[model samples]
Target: MRGYLAAVAGSEPLTPVSRDWARQRTDLEDEVPVVHEETVTGRRYEGDGIRELRIPRFKSVAGRSGDLTQGEWAETALAAAVLADARPVLSPRWKSQQRLTLGRFTPVTHIRVVEIGCVDASRNVLFEGTPEEAHHRYVRMAEARVRAVKAGGDYLPGQGCGACELVDICPAVPSRPGFLGVDSPPARRRSWSMTTARDYRTCPARAHLKDLFLPRAEAAENTPAIVRGQAVHTAIEELHSRSPVRACASTDAPATPEHWRAGRWEVTGFQARLGTQMVGDHALVCPLHELPGDAQVYPERSLVVHDPDADVVVVAKTDLLYRRTDTWFLRETKTVRSLDESDPLLAYPQLALALLLAHEGAVPGTTEEGTTGCRVELERLTGSGPVLTELDGDDGELLAQARRIVTEHATHWHADEEYVARPGKHCETCPVIQWCPSRPEKSAA
Candidate 1:
């Protein structure tokens, strides 16, 4: 991001010797140097003055790579247009103060902006031109998107809520004085999800590193079981996403199990066969089978709410949310090698969030009786077959159990200021262990 900003803002050009020295340093010993590279082309007409460059960096993950969202495009184009029109020059005195290092102030010049994949070495331009051009493009192609964004009124209290200044008065986030069951006062605002809770339980440093968005070991995250699970989910989601939705069929399972692929996820051999069977099993119990054509179906929709009392933003991602009659259903699907007969909520503590949300009326729909009308279902596609179990979300006993599960998971996490590493055997599978200062090293033995 800094490199892109510097390229746009016209930083001091690197001297040839400095560049070579940096390149040499990067290529230490036998390691290949990943030298930063980019190209900016187009003639700078005389008297064009200074240029303000804007680049909207896009995420570089598999499915998200090489694509700039409509919202992002609209924002960048509108910003460039506004900057080109205003062209306000900051005072030199302000720039001179090192305490406030915004940047060196420069006089106005023609503005140019471009959008690119954040990690694309080719830097293939998505949109690039003068600020006036950007404005025209926005007006012609992107104005409606910008307008729609402005018109959006719903507050989605998520991880970002921790950073939101208006959270104190935000009506969406409920203030439950003892929500997380933590007696210790919050050290600072933070976000807590089941994933965070689980990671913290495994190793505090792993959770903290993930919070900081540190680079992770791809191998650790892409284990065969994980990849198979993702592939199964992608396959199931595609079926649910079809227009004029219909019940999933056995034939919908992967035709070529040897090399089955869905979106950016791929699987083969035993994992592929297992995923195929899971998809087939899901076909037998698809929620849409009994629903009317117009039934609302939301797959992998995120449910975010804030607990101001705990100073935490709670986030849960439901596998499937569907409405039938007056009742809403939150279904959590798990692809497992075998079925377990243990208590589902206790076995999968992640379900506690869904259980609580359903009971608290956080989900959209409700029963005709004017009560929270969410039926929490667990769909386990196991090696044997598909199993569907419904938990009575409105039951007081069940709700209490769910609360205990969440509180147990969240209490220690919410109170900790120093997320110190508790290294152990779990470190072998920690994704961000590469960045852990106290990571265990293999013994020479």
Candidate 2:
């Protein structure tokens, strides 16, 4: 009897059982039954919050499996319940379900299969899939669509390849050849930091220019806004190094008037002395200081620190390095719209990279003696500025992910000649649109 039972269990089909088979086999509905039903109509509703839109008991026309067993239904129900509670707590920027039609069948697949995406406020799967994987898939799909359209084979207006950044570079359009001829001159490619390399991977042409051709001027001209932000940040560090420091006892309170003026900065607005509202009748003075610097200020010098395992280089511009007693502090200044300690980009990874570069231990650079911790001062230029915050584990993760992205993208870029475009909303703002071969002729109004 034991051998028979074992054989039965082993030989049982792994294929999902049909809903009818499950219903006939056991009294599962009686155990964990569907309780709620709509009053106005005879339709049954499960109290588990999953409103079953449709449940086709029959096999699909394509001869695919149509069986949704009691166990599978239970799993689906639990998934729906979890999704119900989860959607409300998710981020608002995530993408929802993606609709695709293959031949005559229109199937809507939830983005969750991709693994990495933002969640909506309701905890619903917004952008499904890993961002990196999705980006690559989109690039390949856009390339195929562009090639088809350019070959004049059943290409529809506003169809596939429309969102590609390289739509203007397609050979189908009349002006594309002329445009490529004019802009395809051989030029020297320039070197870029890991951050710049990762950002440009979104555009195939830009990636080719920087990674393959190695042009000096073209690469410099197409640097992303984030890179420019970093450059400006380094310049602020230089300014901060030349200025004096004012230590504050209160976390939210401004600096003292005498200490504020001691720094090499100008003051714009000042309020008069008011009533003292101290804890023990002590007088308190609030002073605001404005530093004379712009966000466009570029660093005069930069130090490159190379990482062999990561296959990239970190560009660091240290503004101030000071030693107090036995420990040394590496101070970096940043200009952001707002500062939050929880933000990874502004915290640990950035500081860690800076510290690693300054120590000259991880990469080749100037070595500092007796370095203990790094200080990051986030300065907002609009109003009362300069809020100092410390970073930890979260920041480190961001840096690691960024490094991985850069290395992976660089590897793909060097291996390919025709870098394909990934189409999306970003394509609307692409600069090379007019030159794309896949672009259709504009209809006259």
Highest lDDT: which candidate?
Answer: 1
lDDT of 1 at 94: 23
Looking at candidate 1, the ten consecutive residues that score lowest on lDDT are 16-25
- Candidate 1 TM-score to native: 0.73
| lDDT on C-alpha atoms for all candidate structures | 0.69, 0.32
* TM agreement with the true structure for every prediction: 0.73, 0.31
Off by over 4 Å in 1: 1-10, 13-73, 85-107, 110-144, 153-177, 214-219, 367-372, 424-429, 434-445
C-alpha RMSD values across all candidates: 11.8, 26.0
1-445, model 1: which lDDT tens digit per residue?
5434433344333221111000001222247653321112222211235343334343333344246576766655565554444322223432322222122323344554444334332233344466567568768766677457645777665566656656656776655556677677766677778989889988888888887755667577568988999999999999998878788999999999887999888899999999999999898999998777777898887766667667777778788888877778898999989899999999888787799877766665553475448889999999999999999886899989999998999988888888899988788878888678897777999
> What is the lDDT for 267 in model 1?
95
Best candidate, TM-score: 1
